[model samples]
Target: MPRVGGTKNVDVAAVIALRPDLVLANKEESSQRDVERLIEAGLPVFVSFPCTVEESLDYVETLARLLHVDAPPRPAPARRQGELRVCAPIWKDPWMTMDGRTYGSDLLSWLGADNVFSDRARRYPLAADVAGAPAADPGARDTRYPRVTAEEIRARGPALVLLPDEPYRFDETHLEEVRSWGVEAALVSGKDLFWYGVRTAGALERLDRALAPHR
Candidate 1:
């Protein structure tokens, strides 16, 4: 069976054929229409919307209970006394970053890192538009992400720039580009920083190691 990418591209027929006992979904990762379609088909769907580290852990436990499995132990927080100012970009071309309200920012906070753009009004703000100016309505939900310019990032003067390999794959070239801004830069796993799962323990260790040099 082919794996459906997400809610927008979910294969309704395939899902129906599977005759699943329960369906797991995310409020942000899956669309309302898709969830409704599954419900209309008489399938059970559990939707999760976790915005912080603690909430995500709770979601994991909830999911485990639904599956009748033992939940993994909650990961201990990576300890650090002081904050490391960091800038993490999820996209480029127009440049986009996460702000205080996003899960990513919250995860960074848990890791003792502070997002340079955390104070922006939007959870995700465009590098070029910190004010989150109105955009032409596309009938789609406004992306929490916002666009920004490289110059704006330079002005923020982050102590470290974390380049993740997802949403937009930032590689060695991107690493160099960020370093050119006169700040230390490192490539990081986007899933490690942004994803919530049993692997959170590994993610925490990886982040601790990455930030160790900077602290």
Candidate 2:
């Protein structure tokens, strides 16, 4: 069910054959090329980009309205669904993250783990900047770190480290290194995390199983 190829790719063709009533997708969530091609094919496609803390909520409200499922959930809507607190390291050497308003933050919102960095002083700051440079003194080198290191990971000790598999592309080599340090880590879909909807709940659960090994 990967977005790029195989069954998921074939899904587009199948859906086209049936001439469904509507097609919904997030601008930031779907592959740019694929979405573009679908549009070129004259499909009735609707796209939106939810890229922030506020915008993400707005996305849900808007999407629900589009699908005619916006009726008030019976009394307690919050308890009906679970959420993940994804931690997307977006920096270079030291690693960093975006604000509560970025697409990465939105993805982690449903990744289901508590984000260890949520309380950090700076938003989207270098790993060394927030956690300190390994063992450096608080008043000096820690303030100017340019990359994340083993010491930082050991100290922060996030419940699960979900790195992006694209843009930065954390691979097996990175996984091997992270495992060696006693920290659990894995790569997740940048799109799925960034572009989830009610239809994607199953996909998220699948993602949870995919990362179960690292847990």
Candidate 3:
């Protein structure tokens, strides 16, 4: 089995000397160069890039499969995406680029919130351009833009703009700034859009109850 080191750099000399059957590593932490070095030293390695809670579940199954162990029970499908118009501005710069297997974009697509980009992985991108965050084809059939103003929040508009509290904490003052753009919006839990374990389906219930129209 592979080892989980508390630190970033590992003592490869000690690990390789043990002659383990298999090794696992995180993609972000265990760089390709590091794994390549291990392979050059004659160790078989598997890398994981689990960022969200769902990927954590998948990693468990992958580990079990590799170990010839029975997987945990299959869960019921997650709830349907709610019917609503949602404009999300949760862009991260340098493109954190959610894995296709991640949760955030999946939630948006599943909930029928009209996603903006389709760059393979269902992840939030760290977009450097503020314009990128607000961009969508004006003639696009399904997509809609939230009434927003880079100029000022008081001048902005949106039925419900979800300001996230992650990557950076968007507070009341920030909300007021966005509201100043002539849009009334709510601050949503970033984790809710991204993380889901046992509550994956239940979270949908909460979102519908909280966000959808009363009709």
Candidate 4:
């Protein structure tokens, strides 16, 4: 069934009514309170927190083992030419990006692209700084996905910008705007960059093709 909302806002009644034997949750996406509620109601919930690329791969294998299902062959991503300096924004309104510790960033590295903010302290950085201005909340970790500003993006001066399709859809309009800033930009599938396991192989191929123009 189509999940009406995100894991944090899933339909509890609908899920319980389905009478599923096991519930798969994520430490980052699913709330602890929700997991506990499901557990109290006699449901088994398996929570996963796959922050890095390798960890995400491991998470799938672990899940398969738990379910006693045959795991698919592991994906092997071909390495790319480590030349592009990339800035990938996942959201807008208050721009957000994947930092060094995130699965997406790891994927970017695996593809041979260097994330400009990989050394950033937060996994998701709030580019509160605009037009080379200072951040209003430099140390705020209130949300894993931090907010950013356009000026900050310019200041970072990345050679390329990757805009993902989900969490916040970055369409052609967004792509043009990024290009206007004198940086090469493209729309990318969030799943390919963020999802691991069976999807990793395809993601690698897609990313390679997407970045070919800039190479």
Candidate 5:
């Protein structure tokens, strides 16, 4: 595979130069402008945006069909029963977490873990997401990942706080900080929590095991 560019700012010209059979992108990861540019340049682009584990499996099947390859076996549904209240922060500073509509949230849900911020929506104007500024109309903004305050997190009262090592690279220090909140916390693989497709099954197994002790 050749290096086209970063996820959010793909080099359209470079992609066009390669002239591949098909281009795969994620709606959230890749920029819409780049995808549009590729399409305008007569390149086939398939954009995926799966919000749940089941939808991700569907995306896998769709890709296999598009590439004329056999689809891999799907992972079994979560075997657990009860739900564990969890807060998996993707970033710090202002602190951000995924809502129920996001794939990461659904992934955690599959492992019998409920995201504490599932009902929260990202407020527009960014400032509104942090400082207590007024939020934009819901119809005008994307409302998936919400910026939250530490106080708000404490209010949610998550039983366990999962710290993924990506997007923000939560380390031992961050883990200790989260533990200081007086809740059970653990460091987890960011890819397992965020990435989908072929890794989904393995991610499910790994996360399931990781959450087992807490549950």
Candidate 6:
């Protein structure tokens, strides 16, 4: 296994030099320009962007077919009886969280947790996401990750605030801060929450266990 480059800044020349059979990429993680470059170089590339747990499993099956490999059997997700109100913040500094449209939110939903901001969507002009700005038209912009405020989160009244360590690296310090908002908070693995494909089943199980006590 060789390192072509980071998600955003892939080394196109290095990848082309490898002369591999196929290049795998994620629409959200990898840069569009890089994927285009690989295609322009006559390299076969498979770009995936699954927005739900079911879709992720489908992606795994598709990838397996492309590579002539057997797709691992999907794991059974443990669903709880009652729903736990959850707000998972991916980033701070104008705090942002995933809405219902995202894979993360759907994953949580499958585990019997309700996303507090599931109906909220990101507003354009960035500043419009927070207070004191006019709302952006939902039809005109991407609205999966919405920027939120501490006050707004408090108002949503989530029973558990899940803080992931990627996209923003929320740690113990952040956990304490979130708890201060009058809610139970925990630091969970970002990869489990965001990463899809072969790990989807395990991620769901891990996250379900993490949210079990809260439920």
Report lDDT (CA) for all predictions.
0.80, 0.54, 0.54, 0.77, 0.88, 0.89
TM-score versus the correct structure, for each prediction: 0.88, 0.48, 0.53, 0.85, 0.95, 0.94
RMSD of 5: 1.4
Query: How many residue pairs clash in all the candidates, one count each?
Result: 10, 15, 19, 2, 0, 0
- Where model 2 places Cα greater than 4 Å from the true spot, the runs are 1-87, 98-103, 106-111, 121-150, 196-203
* Residue pairs of candidate 4 with colliding backbone atoms: 127-148, 131-151
Predicted candidate 5 versus true structure: per-residue lDDT over 1-215, tens digit per residue: 78877898778899899998999998888878888998999999999999889898999999999999998886677646677999989899879998889989998888889898999889987788877899778794578989898888888999999999998899999888878888889999999999988888899899998998988
Better TM-score candidate (2, 3)? 3
- Give candidates' CA RMSD values in order: 3.0, 9.8, 8.0, 3.2, 1.4, 1.6
Which sections of candidate 4 miss by over 4 Å? 1-5, 121-144
Tell me how candidate 4 scores on lDDT.
Answer: 0.77
lDDT of 6 by residue, 1-215 (tens): 89977988889999999998999999888888889989999999999999998899999999999999988886666555567889999989989999999999989998889999999978876778887588757784568998889999999989999999997899999988887777899999999999888889889888988987787
Worst-scoring 10-residue span by lDDT in model 2: 71-80
Write model 3 residue lDDT over 1-215, tens digit each, in one string: 55645336777767688877787776555656768878888988878765444565677678778878897764554546444444455542222223223355566555555433333222112231223454334452222112222542222222555667774567797679657766666777766765544455555555555566521
Candidate 1 on 1-215: residue-level lDDT in tens? 56866666888778877879998888877878888988999999999877777788888898899999999887667555568999999999878888787877887887789889887533332322754455454345455666777887888878999999997999999989888778899999999888876666677778878888887
lDDT of 2 by residue, 1-215 (tens): 22434423435655566665667766444656666666677777777775543455566677677778863332211211344333556544656554454544544455445555555534233433545434434542222113444565567666566766655677788777777877677777665554544424444565666655644
Q: Which residue pairs clash within candidate 1?
A: 124-146, 125-146, 126-146, 126-147, 126-148, 127-147, 127-148, 127-149, 128-147, 128-148
How does residue 66 of candidate 5 score in lDDT?
98
Q: How should the candidates be ordered by TM-score, best one leading? A: 5, 6, 1, 4, 3, 2
Off by over 4 Å in 3: 1-30, 38-45, 49-60, 67-70, 78-83, 91-102, 116-158, 196-210, 213-215
Model 1 / residue 118 / CA error / Å: 1.0
